[model samples]
Target: MKKSQALYRSVLIIILCGVGFMYSQSESVYQQVEEAVANSISKGVQVGQEALPIQLETLKGEQVSLDDYLGQPVVVNFFATWCHPCQEEMPIIVEMEKRLKEKGAAFVAVNMTSQESSKDEIAPFLQHYRATFDPLLDKDGEIMKKYQIIGIPTTLVIDENGIIVQRINGGLTFELMEDLVIFRE
Candidate 1:
């Protein structure tokens, strides 16, 4: 009877240890993923009442700045070819662009530097997706670093005066995007 009790105690201790180890491992993984996503979504115009400065390259290799669009509302979306959420959201963004353009709004996209892709690779992705907007190449990730991008799909809405009014993190549908782009309080 004492031998059986000892054996049962041993099993219980082993099971408890296993449970503890599993919980710790799961927590570690969760934190890693959370940090990664936080890093990607890290780049934004600014946090409340402050606007981020603008200076970035265009797809055609032209230098552009927010000052250039002073009199027009501008939408800047940071996207990557390999990100699944970005791919799913692109069509909706395209439609949003179309509707905004019809309302005289301007929009552009910045393609984050991708080790998994080249400009050649990206061109086809854009073409196949029917994304009509010019996608700037952040090949060196300098802009990404500047923006502090921790994530794939992020957006900034700059008003006519060139002040960034809203920065949306993550993928958004057309209607929600429209609300951000066209409406300004």
Candidate 2:
């Protein structure tokens, strides 16, 4: 009877230790996952920072640089032709540009052509949306990487002094676009 009791206690201790080990490992794994998510979420440039340099060719084949518009507010939108949200947001962006350009604000839509199949589609796409403002092509995706663009339809609002005032990750409604560029509060 004494031997049996001792053996039972030993087995119970082993089981408990095994459970504790598993719990510790699971906790470590959870922490690692949490850290990774936080890093990814914080990857993009923040507001109040200076806008990164961008020099690219417009669909019209003209070279444009962000520095050229530093004395006035500039709207830099990163997009791809194939992105549906980008297509949907173009009209709103066009209106926003019209309203803001009167106030001396510049708008540039940087096309992510590196991910696009053919550059031939860009002109037709712009014509379809009646996008009258500058449409720059990021042929090598360098500008997109410089901006840390994680998704399509990302817009950055840079103030006259070249400071980034706002960063938007998704499509913008007309109201939202107006609020961002006009009000900016």
Candidate 3:
């Protein structure tokens, strides 16, 4: 009976130790997420801040406004036709857009029209990437300046209430894209 009691106590200690280790690991993960969110909030346009208004025309000459998407989560991407990183990430962005559409998220691509050599370059770039969504044209780069976009291929995830939730400075991967839109709080 004494030996059995000692074995039970040892097993109990092992289980308690395992639980403590798991809890510590979860706490570490939580801390990392908190830090990442805090850092993202300090960048351009700022997270938790209401998005700057954008009203621009699409390649087909249709006027689109950010206000139009106010009640839905929006993914706003600022890109130029000539940007290499933008070119590489275009397909991934397009795929993410489709995936998030069912959940009522609107994906808006703002082309830095002023940065393009000619308007002609836009069509071929979109065609090559097979991006079916029409991109809004920032004709005078006024929208870009409003958002303080210093880099190409910058993407912002705005929540349903028009607040900027996440701002990505570079190209996106599928996993990051999922985290930004689908899995985020």
Candidate 4:
């Protein structure tokens, strides 16, 4: 009887130790997952996050940087000429250009040149749309990837301090654009 009791106690102690080790391992995994989520939230495209720095040449060949517009509100759009939604968004953007500028905000369009069949399509598209903003050429798609842009017509409405105030994933109306960038207090 005493032997059986000692053996049972030994088994119980082993089981308890195993459970404790498993709990510790699970706690470590949970902390790792928590840290990864926090990092992603800080780095990814989100409203109130600082806009990533962009340096690229315009279709006109002039160089520009997002930093140049640091002290002014800016609208940063990622678009391709082939995208119908981007094409549709052009008119509203064109209409708002002058008005946004008057409100002390600069409009910046980043052309996803890498997605185009030919670089020549850009000039005509801009001309056809009567777009007033000079488009920054993202020739290698690096900027798009950096911004983690999963969709066309992604617009980042950045405030004067360079914090993204809004992230519009698809085409936005003129009134909505005004409400986002112009009419904001």
Q: Summarize candidate 4's per-residue lDDT along 1-185 as a digit string, tens digits.
A: 99999999999999999999999899899999999765654434689677788999998899999989988888888889999998888888887777777877788999999889998999999899888778999999999889988899998888776778889899878778867844667
- Deviation in Å, model 2, residue 92 alpha carbon: 0.3
What is the C-alpha RMSD, rounded to one decimal, of candidate 4? 10.1
Model 3 residue 132 lDDT score: 85
Question: Model 3: what TM-score?
Answer: 0.74
Segments in model 4 whose C-alpha atoms lie over 4 Å from true places: 1-44
Per-residue error at 80 for model 3, in Å?
A: 0.9
Q: How do all models score by TM-score?
A: 0.67, 0.73, 0.74, 0.74
TM-score attained by model 1: 0.67
Candidate 3 lDDT: 0.87
Candidate 4 displacement at residue 103 in angstroms: 1.2
Q: In angstroms, give how far residue 146 of model 4 lies from its true place.
A: 0.8
**Model 1, residue 148: C-alpha shift (Å):** 2.3
Candidate 2 pairs with clashing backbones: none
Superposition error at 23 for model 3 (Å):
41
**lDDT (10s digit) by residue, model 1, range 2-99:** 99999999999999999999998998999999897655543245743324555666676797765666788878888988889899898988887787
Better of 1 and 3 by lDDT: 3
1-185, model 3: which lDDT tens digit per residue? Answer: 99999999999999999999999899899999999876665423778787888898899999999999988889998999889999889889889778778777889999999999998899989898888889999889898888988998999988887888899999998778878854566
Candidate 2 TM-score to native: 0.73
